[model samples]
Target: MANQASIETRDVRLWYGEFQALKGIDLDVSRGRITGLIGPSGCGKTTLLRCFNRINERYDYVRTEGSLIIDGHNIYAPDVDLIELRKRVGMVFQRPNPLPISIRDNVLYGYRLHTPKAERSRGAEDEALESALKSVQLWDILKDRLGDRATRLQLEQQQKLCIARLLPLKPSIILMDEPCSALDPDATAKVEELIRQIAGEFTILIVTHNMAQARRVSDECVFMLIGEIVEHGRTEDLFIAPKDQRTADYIEGRFG
Candidate 1:
């Protein structure tokens, strides 16, 4: 049976002032699967990803139209609590961005935010920190250094920490935008492995410029061009036999 959609967009359009970045996109990202959004830099892959948690509206001039639904709720509805929405839909950026704090603090940041002070005791925080770190495969390596500064860790570990930090929030969907772009080849491979390890536990929608990464890490793929989705399908089907000529050309490196 097909997986239910974790995120669904219907005729979703976005604008930064007057410039349309996303033009009436209709897409579905399946629950507990990795979905890759691929396109050139100027395409709307990142824009569409940001719409999930309404992060695009952070820019004062940004505007959006149509429905962006996540887990059966329309995220754009006025009654929607942005904080709660963000808790359910966490995001990781292009580069590893750990805060200037201790490793334990970083991991517990989101948990602390959503949790009340009286309910958040040392024991609970410790358990959450350990669990989150272990989920991202960082516990063994960083357990002894919980008090160490997060920014001082290796890039790979830092990136993992960024991911680890999200787990405590119990997110339903994780949005990653070029998550490994800042890492070296070896680090990239390791991060990809980590991403694969965490799949099926959370719905992940990743935007990547690396076609190979998309193929390796994603179960499904989306191809966009000029602010439109050209094609979307199972990863193997899309890569092996793209239905759209534009998708084929781009995949074959004929053009972006």
Candidate 2:
């Protein structure tokens, strides 16, 4: 079946000075579906994720060769506006790194990043912030005490706040790098539920080490080895009956 591509990587290659990180990788991300990137450490999952935001381009030694298209625009092109690109493709990291400010402050950070000081309105900002918290199911828990320190919230609440923080921008896609890695089981479940609720609203690409998590949340799965993709297919087919020996071995827990 042909999936509508929300993001695509065509003959993409990455290098850190002379050392190559990604080897002519080709990737297709389905619109409004979850795509899981599973591979051992340093196999380039995070590197590839960073590419979506042109985060790789910021590093001095890093150089990219090929096309990364998002919503039909060649993002790797010379004139792509990186600031705007990031606003459209938001990211959540492995750790829940909330700001040292109030919960409301954390959620408004992205708005501040994209909106100019001259154009930003206090009322508009508040409305956007509240809407974001609601989207992540965090508004009720945080609504009463918007002025309290962000860290005062429970760890789970804080993580959701971090997610809430990003949602205000209404990004078309979200890149999650091991988002539930640091949470307890209950917190993890909450995060997983949030994923299900938000998947259809935003195109999501996740990098996870947990095989079960991949099977649980992903619509499509990509398995990589030594910086090269060994297999890519529908999550059910890949997990139930992977065609490649390496993919089968990795998923079977013989190797990562």
Candidate 3:
């Protein structure tokens, strides 16, 4: 079967006040695969990632134009529910920002919010917690320390916990913005491996300044410059033989 697009954008544009951050971007992010967005700082990669969940709207002056569809739904449709949309599209930030609550609580936070108290049972909650942690490869290490504060965990584990928290919500797509930027080389590699392991189950769009990390973890790559996508192709093709001179220059380290 042909691969399906999990998210599709047609002439998507964003403006923060008078500054246009994204300029008529059209791209299709494949389902069950990892798509990497790479560019220098302020290139709008992160802004595009935030658009998937409508998080950019948090800014009062921000305005978006064009269509952004996720899993066949036009996210900007007037009837769409923001809460439900966020539940379907989760985001992980650059640094590990676990709440000071217990590890188990952190993992179950979204689950509890989306699910009513009457619908939640002890066994179901336990199962959900274990399943989420296991999916992120954190179950074995933190199983016995579920009551410990999440912020006290190591940076890598805290980051993984942030990802685990999202799984219970069963998000259709996960947006990661510079997810490993705050980690060391070793921690970054670990997180990258975890990301690869989870790719087939969920559509992932990750923004990373580290080109090597993008090549290692993503199935396809999108290169952007000055608020627009310059080139996008399979990871190997985009890196080895870019169709655009600008893409070749960026990949070859001529300029960011």
- Per-candidate TM-scores read 0.98, 0.94, 0.98
Using lDDT, give the best candidate's number. Answer: 3
Evaluation by lDDT, superior candidate among 1 and 2: 1
Off by over 4 Å in 1: none
Which has the better TM-score: candidate 2, or candidate 3?
Answer: 3
lDDT of 3 by residue, 35-125 (tens): 9999888999999999999999989999999999988889999999999999999999999999999999999999999999899999999
Tens digit of lDDT per residue, candidate 1, span 131-250? 999988899999998999999999999999999999999999999999999999999999999999998989999999999999999999999998999999999999999999989999
lDDT score, residue 23, model 3?
A: 98
Cα lDDT listed for each candidate:
0.94, 0.89, 0.95
**TM value for model 3:** 0.98
- Report residue 21 deviation for candidate 2 (angstroms): 1.0
Clashing pairs in 2: none
Residue 60 deviation, candidate 3, in Å? 0.8
Error of 1 at 233 (Å): 0.1
Residue 129 of model 3: what lDDT? Answer: 99
> By the lDDT metric, which is better: model 1 or model 3?
3
lDDT of 2 by residue, 35-60 (tens): 99998888898899999998877779
